[model samples]
Target chain A: MANDHILKRFDEELERLNATINEMGGLTEAQFAKALQAVRDRDTAIAEEVIADDARVDALDVVVQEQTVKMLALRQPMAVDLRVVLSSIKIAAALERIADYAKNTAKRSIVLAQGSAPPSAVAGIDRLGRLVRAALKDVLDAFADDDVAKARDVWDRDEEIDQVYTGLFRELLTYMMEDPRTITACTHLLFMAKNIERAGDHVTNIAELVSFRNTGQNFAEARRKGSGALYTTDTAP
Target chain B: MANDHILKRFDEELERLNATINEMGGLTEAQFAKALQAVRDRDTAIAEEVIADDARVDALDVVVQEQTVKMLALRQPMAVDLRVVLSSIKIAAALERIADYAKNTAKRSIVLAQGSAPPSAVAGIDRLGRLVRAALKDVLDAFADDDVAKARDVWDRDEEIDQVYTGLFRELLTYMMEDPRTITACTHLLFMAKNIERAGDHVTNIAELVSFRNTGQNFAEARRKGSGALYTTDTAP
Candidate 1:
């Protein structure tokens, strides 16, 4: 009877970890959304809110860490349980970083609001943000459902985000080259785009973690990098 | 007698892990240096070499992971051993990312070679890369010696890298504003500068990991973000 009670408690603790991860994942999704809205609408108030909410995400991350270490030391999970625990630890870290990136994008939004931001560039960011937000949601769903197939699908979609980002990067460079007046605003937009694209990468990482949790396989080689190399070409005189 | 033999074998395994981590660290430092020299000298050959060498770094990262998982499963380390193992996992991951950023910079260097890169901007990147490479070495030394003090000192030095990066960012903006022809070159330099700055952050993380291994503390709240916000101001008309 005592052994049964201990095993049940371990299950409960594992469930609790999952619940916390889901909670943190939801908040990062919200953070990314607000940050995107802040940039698209030039809403500094919303941007500040995204920045302010980062502390909460960080706190949850600490909870995840404490729980991970506690479980590892006390429960000493093995095999599948161990993999789940390890992957959750990584997923929590990725969520914290995603929140950080959201905060960075919000900061850029505030700065862009302070000046003249080009509508076209902001629109491009909006498109990229939409794609990333969707991917984040998908990855989170995969995590919650323990659905590796969905995670694989999310992983493949990262190439789409890369394509969009590369396209937007080229557009911004052309905007600067064609009209130097837009150079300053375009530069800020450039950073903002990079921030959003990087956020997409974190989301992709979460997807990979979800898959690793299930399969115990390393998917690093399968990733297709975005065309970031294309823009580095010598368009200079 | 049997326990003694098992314990000694565990020690040997731990030592091997440390040896591999140091090897990876040395490679990342060399990769960053070569990428820097490639950018500074506009040498495509050196850049190609950096790009080619990245696969070796990635393979080392895989080895680290395999060892980490094997140790956790077979040895089931505890207390100080657990902390050391966890810190090494993070440190190894950070080194891999630093190598990746170096590879990105090398790719940019190749592109910059095709165009007219501004000498001033290349000089700025060189300065930032030198600072980052030195810090990387110090963190590795601290790791090898298990010296928390040197690790903490390295953590404090990251602020200087931020300052250099922010100053370079502003200078690039001003150059782009004054001379339209240099905008393309300066833009690439800006990305390269960000890459170097990011590598510095990874180094700082390694420093913090070293301290964590010894003290069991998370020093994240103590970080001072550089003046990235300084350049994102209302400099636009």
Candidate 2:
């Protein structure tokens, strides 16, 4: 009877921990959405809101971390339960980091909105932001459903985001070279694009966590990475 | 007598955990140093060594994480013990990421070494890398000694690194604009400088974890961040 009671309490704490992480995930997703909207609409007001809301995501991250520690200390969960709690901490941190990258992208919008950015650059930024946001949503769904296949799909798709980013990087460099006046705006756009690429990396981090939660092992080999021409040149393969 | 025995066992496990983290920190510092040397001396061999050393850091991170979870699950540590275990996981992950940045910096050295990089740009990168390596060392020492003040010192010093990075960024852009022939080399330097800056950020992350472990509270207010001119222009503040 005592063992049964202990197990019941453990289950309750696990549910609460899961709920806290889910809430954190929701806030992070909302923040990223607002950030993307801010960029697309060139609305500094929305950008500021996204920045302000980042505090909330940071706060929720703290809550998730605290709850995971509490569960581990109190319940002493083993095996899968242990993985879930540990992964919760990692997933929350990844979500919070993704939100930070989104905030970073929004931060650039203030400066970028002032300049006359080219239509092609703006479209490129929007496309990359859209894909990253989609990946974030899918990873969250995978977490909710404990779907390893879905998580793996998100992991595999990061290569496409990287390819898009590489194209944008070269395009921006060309613009700056042609027109010195475009340097500042183009630089901000480059940072914004890099921020989005990092957010994609964080999405993959969450995917890896989801995989760990469902399966007891990490991916056996190095995950496939798209060729980054910037760093790959001159390397002896 | 039985209670004393349990406490003794707990102390031993905590010591093992601490030792593992310190070892990880040592490896990370070494990687960053080799990466810096690769940039300074243009030694691709050292760069390759740094890249290969990264796997060892990754392996150690997994070991620390597994040990932390095992301790939490088996011992159900509370109070300071609980904080140590939780923070160890955070700290180990931070160290692993720092190593990654080092690897990234090293990777760029391969391409940068192939071309004629400016002596001044190389010096600038060396300076930034040195400071970040110092910060990593201090933070790790702070962790080992549980010295919150030392950790806070490292945290506060990150601004200097950021200021250096901003100056370097502008300088590199000017170089590229003045001489298009310098573009490729300057671009590689720019990425390497950014990698060093990011490594500084990871150092601060470890500092924050150290502070939290010692004090059980995060910083009272938002951590002071150096103003980034790349993104913050004409903002209605």
Candidate 3:
């Protein structure tokens, strides 16, 4: 009876950790969405909100980290349980980075809003942000559901974000070259786009973590690097 | 007697892990130097070598991760020993990322060599790379010697790289605006500078990890973010 009670308590702690991760993941998703809206709608208020909310996400990440460490130290979970805690730490850290990137995109939104520049590339950035936000949502769903197939699908789709980013990078460079007046706004847009794309990468990393936690196998090699070399000749002058 | 033998074996495994980390760190330092030289001298061959040598660094990182996981699973180390293993994993991962950034800079060197672009911003990038490489070396040394003070100094110096990068960013943008012809080469140089600056951030992260492992304290907030906001009003045309 005592052993049963101890196991029940351990399960409760594990569930609590999962709940914290889910909360952090949900906030990160909102963070990315707000940053995107701020960029697309020229809503600096929303941007400010994204920036301010980052602290909450950051605090939750620390909470998750602390809880995971404590569980590892006290419970000494074996095998699958240990992997869950380990992957939770990785996921929390990745979420924190995603939040940071969102904050960066939001910061750029203020500068972008102030400029009376053409919105030629703004649509492109919005599209990129939407794709990333969707991917992040899917990855989090995969985590919550423990659906390996969903995670794999999310991993595969990261290449699509990369392709879009590279195309926009080229088009923006051309815009800057063709019209110097657009340089200031275009540069901010460039950074925002890169930030959003990087956020996609973190989502992909989280997807990989989910898969790693599910299967005791390291999928490091099998995870496709959708980045496709930023130094490609397409960006050359 | 058997317990004594097992305890000694555990210590030996930890020593082996440290040796692997040192080897990886040494290789990463060399990679950064080669990449820096490649950028400064337009040495494509050296840049190619840096790119090619990345595989070795990557393989070592995997080794470190596997060993850390194995140790954690089998030994269930407590307190300081646990922190050491955890920090080792974090440090190795950071080192691998730093090396990847170095490789990215080197890849840009090839395209840079093919162009007859003016050497206007290369000097700034070289300075930034030198500072980051030195910081990385110091952090690795601190890790090896358990020198908290040295790690703290390294952490304090990341702001210098960030300042230099921001200055170079402004200067390059000005050059691009003044002469649209420099846009291609300047863009590549800008990315390289950002990569080097980011590598410095990872070095600072390692420094914090060193401090945390020794003190069993989490110093997440104490690490000043030198990135200051990327949206600073400097690039406004």
Candidate 4:
């Protein structure tokens, strides 16, 4: 009976941890969308909101990490439970960084809004943001369902985000070269694009972690260059 | 007698971990210096070496992390020893990232070397790299000597890095606006500078961890914006 009670408490804590992570992901996704909108619409209010709200995300990150540490110290869970706790800690940090990046993008948007006309070159930025958000969503879903196939799909999407970033880079460069006045805003957009690119990388990290949790096998092949095909490997098999 | 033997083994393992970290820091410092020279002097060979040698740094990071984990699992260290093991893991990851940034800067040097005039605007980048490298060295020194004051000094130096990054942003913007032909290389340089700036931030993270390990206090003041003061007040004092 005592063993059963302990197991029940462990399960409850795990559930609570997952709930917090998902809530944090939702907040991050909302901020990412607002950041893009702020850039496109030149909405300084929204940009400032994103920046101010970053503290909340930072606080949540600290809370989640503390909880994970406590669980490690108290429970000393092994295998799957241990991996989940470890992954939660890292993924929480990654999400907080993503929020920071979004806030940075919003800050740039404010500067760009105060300056010259919005450059048409930012179309790629919007697309990249959507791609990364979708990737994050997919990774979260995979985590909830333990669907390794879905995680693999998220990993595959990173290449697309990278391509969009490359195209955006070229377009932004052309804009900056054409007019010196556009330099400040265009450079800000460049950072925003890089942030989105990094968010996609984080999503990939989450997906890899999900796969590891479902399977004991290490995904060493996916860590290398030109490893795009490795992302297609179905962890279900 | 068994407890005494375990304590001795734990101390020896801790000493080994510290030595490895110090060695890793030295290698990273050397790499950063060589990367800066490669950019300034257009030394392709040195740049290539930095790129090729990144694997060693990554491997060292893995080894350090594994050792720390083993200690935690086997020895079950408490209080200060536990903090030391945990902080070592985080510090190893940060150092690996800083090394990665150095490799990134070196890679950009190759592209910059291909330019017609060596991108006259790279002076800001040079300054930023120097600042970041110095900050990293301070943080590592603090870790080695457990000097909380030196760690606080590292935190203060982050602002100088941020200032240099801001200046570099404007200069790179001008380079991109000046000519479309310079776009590809200038964009690369921008990413490199951002990487270095991020490396500095990671050093700050290490500094905070050092403080946390020494004192049970979290030092929440470090998270405040524009708190560029070189000294931290001990709450107990």
Ranking by lDDT: 3, 1, 2, 4
Q: For residues A163-222, could you state the per-residue lDDT of candidate 4 as single tens digits?
A: 777777767767766775676667677777777887788888888888887785545553
Give the B-chain TM-score of model 2.
0.93
Cα lDDT of model 2 by residue, A65-107, tens digit? 7887777777787788888888998898898899888888888
B97: Cα error in model 1, Å:
1.8
Score every model by TM-score.
0.88, 0.91, 0.88, 0.87
**Candidate 3: lDDT of B57?**
99
Q: Tell me the spans in candidate 1 whose CA falls farther than 4 Å from its real position.
A: A1-10, A74-78, A215-221, A226-237, B1-10, B73-76, B216-221, B226-237
Q: Per-prediction RMSD in angstroms?
A: 3.6, 3.3, 3.3, 5.9
Candidate 4 Cα outliers beyond 4 Å, as residue runs: A1-6, A218-220, A224-237, B1-6, B117-119, B175-181, B217-220, B224-237
Backbone clashes under 3 angstroms, per model: 0, 0, 0, 2
Q: List DockQ for all candidates.
A: 0.31, 0.39, 0.33, 0.27
The alpha-carbon root-mean-square deviation between model 1 and the true structure, to one decimal in Å, is 3.6
Residue range A1-237, candidate 3, lDDT tens digits: 987886787799989999999999999999999988998899999988997789999899889967876776567677788888889988999999999999888888888888865686999999989999999999999999998889989888888888898888888888889987777677777777777888898998998999999996655664454235535632322
Question: Model 2, range B42-141, lDDT digits (tens) per residue?
Answer: 9999998998789999999999978887787678888888887888888898899899889888888988888988889889999989999999999989
The deviation in Å at residue B153 for candidate 2 is 3.4
lDDT of 1 by residue, A7-30 (tens): 787799899999999999999999
Question: Which scores higher on DockQ, 2 or 3?
Answer: 2
Error of 2 at B58 (Å): 1.4
Better candidate by TM-score, 2 or 4: 2
Report the lDDT of model 4 for residue B28.
Answer: 86
